[model samples]
Target: MKNCTLDLLGIKDSRLQFDPKYKNKVTTDDFYNHRKARFIHLLQSYPCFCPVCGKKMKRNGFKTVEMVGLPSGGLTNIFSIRKQKYLCPSSAACPKTITKLAEVQDVKANARISQAVKYQAVSKLGQNISQKYIATDFCISSMTVMRFAQGVSTYLKPNQHYLPQNIAFDDFKSGNFSQSGMSIIVMDIATHRTLDIVRSRQNTYLRSYFLQYDRQARWAVQTVTVDLYSPYRAFIHDVFPNALIIADRFHVITQAYRALNQVRIQAMKQAGHGSHNSRALKHYWKLLTKDSAHLDFKHYHKSRNFRNLQLCEQDIVERLLAMSADLRLAYNYYQTLLQAVHQGNPALLEELTQSAAGLPDPVKKTNRTLRKHRQEIKNSFETTFSNGPIEGTNNKIKTIKKTAYGFRNFENFRLRILVELKNSYVSLNFHSA
Candidate 1:
């Protein structure tokens, strides 16, 4: 036995010993008690100093044994920590005393799971997994998961310049009819990112937000594309005087088509069954709305009877598309309208009224609305920009909504969107940390 040391059993280390009596005697209780001391030793190895005071601390004693780990979601280990308290030496003046190391893991010392675990849970499951399922996976209560998710949400912070230069404004229904909720969204056109979102479509709210911005930011906006909402027009003029406003081509076309649909439906109702024109109208409805180039010959043949209605709709669509082109002097007039409105040229109003008179009732009505808010529409074309980015961002937001089922609490939803938006910009190298 040269330099042999004794092991825990007080036996010489050299011996390869085995006892038959010890085989059946070992039990769970024996193993647990044996590991308890080792677990405490492991905890002591990682000492926590007061973040504010920068002072070394000693354990006063075990305060309480708490379940302070994420429920084992089959992915991570669950922890039940025996919280130990430490008291600082300068207790009289020092604000915090008797701090607990377990607080790092547990959001609150008494919480059943650690904050890290909760975050992991959210990252892993998101909205796809139900709260009940999360609880079962983690072997924790659903309330714990909910609390953990909330705790993680507190860290998201909104940044400055959240709104982009070119933006899109749109309204979406937040809730069902009677309890109807409405939200107005602004998106960055270039990146298709949501720049800002407001819970209400109220003009006052829009005006207030713009009023808060300094003149430089207000003027920095190049273009805003939106539907023909009168209040939106008013707010845009009051806030972004220098910016161009674009009546989104999509919105204009959709509105026109919707009106055509109404007309078709009415016509159908008046016509008796088996009428050639009625059947023709039904067959040509799709052809009328669809681009002819995209339609197959079979569908074109089917629509032959309703050629006049289709021609009417097609002519309107083609004119609108041509308005977007540089060749048409109409585009020039469109841009001039905004400039004249901004310069307070009374002649521009008369010109717009004349233009309004030549159009069909639907186009005339739309033109009238545009004339009423001439300044805003003029601003749109003059601005030469659209909220394309913001619209793109809204699509992403919708995706997020769909992925998460739907969020009941708007605040949480808002925070999540903001955080995700910031994260996206950061990823694109467009944002500073």
Candidate 2:
């Protein structure tokens, strides 16, 4: 016979994958409820001495302790432990005077679920799973899931004392109303880890909040990437004098394209709102936003509408630009600026900004704004830094919030983000807790 063979019957229990620790002492008994399989584990203990007294004691009786458990046999689970109880013949023999129960395994006080169940639930929480689902899966209450999430967050939480040399800053909507909070997150650009979060993006509050960090940590920062927010730019200047501010290319293009869209709208109106040119302009709006390099100049229109001109994306853009000289100038400037940033031509940017007198008011305004932070705009060419990572992090935060139905407290929301971020990349372990 082989030394080891596959236990096909043992392979039948899926709960084993959930890490059942007390295998030697716990026995599994399962039944069906409403045609659904349910698991019950009977927990008992061997005779042992009290840790405090270190004196062997006879097992006098058993007390039933029920705990939430992971799913087993493709169904729900329940654990009923016959927890051991020992009687000290002489009260003086027990060193700890108050306790009557002898410990067998570690479990949280006044908690129905075992630590194992809590752990597995917390691990799922980090994946942005709904608490209701976790509660049902682990046979626990939603509140217990919340408590576990909070603990797991605290465990994997980063050190707040340090901010890395390269950093990115961006704000996300915490609540919808004007009276609601505006939350901004600071991230370490090198490690791409979130540093900390603040409840408000207001200048006064942000300045005061960042000022509290260690001076050396502030000085350690070498570069900061920011969106077009002037206050954020100003805040970085004052707080991190040694760091160069790099305006993210994505934000610059985003703002420029926003202005370009306005120009396009004006072109449509000039073409007559209901006219063929204007309708084509609206239908081919996506064509304008696309990169010219990707445009198929020979491609023909397939749809049969008002005009079957069979114009490719490039041809459509050219026709759209021909609608108005002002629109042409704005589109040219938008494309040129994108190229300048991309090709690292600071001189081109300077020329375009300085000669903005001929552009539409919107384009001129955008150029002026870019020129105001001229040095930061130029700095984008020096390094690759973007709030791109911030988008991914924000998506995770949004997922966590949505899954939880929504967090009423900002601190809990913040904690959930912190832990959930870590949870995605790191496996949950007892040592981590």
Top candidate when judged by TM-score against the true structure: 2
lDDT of 2 by residue, 284-403 (tens): 888787767778877677533335656667777887787789988988888888788788899988987887878898998898888887888899888878889988888877777778
**All models: lDDT?**
0.52, 0.71
Error of 1 at 184 (Å): 1.1
Task: State residue 390's C-alpha deviation in candidate 1, in Å.
Answer: 4.7
RMSD of each: 11.0, 5.4
Candidate 2: stretches off by over 4 Å: 1-45, 48-55, 91-99, 156-158, 176-180, 300-307, 422-433
* lDDT for each residue of candidate 1 in 219-250, tens digit (9 for 90 to 100): 78877788777668778877888767777644
Worst 10 residues of 1 by lDDT: 36-45
**Which parts of model 1 are misplaced by more than 4 Å?**
1-64, 68-76, 82-111, 122-163, 176-180, 293-360, 370-408, 419-433
Pairs of residues at least 3 apart in sequence or in different chains that clash in candidate 2? none
How many collisions per candidate? 20, 0
The candidate 2 region of ten consecutive residues with least summed lDDT is: 1-10
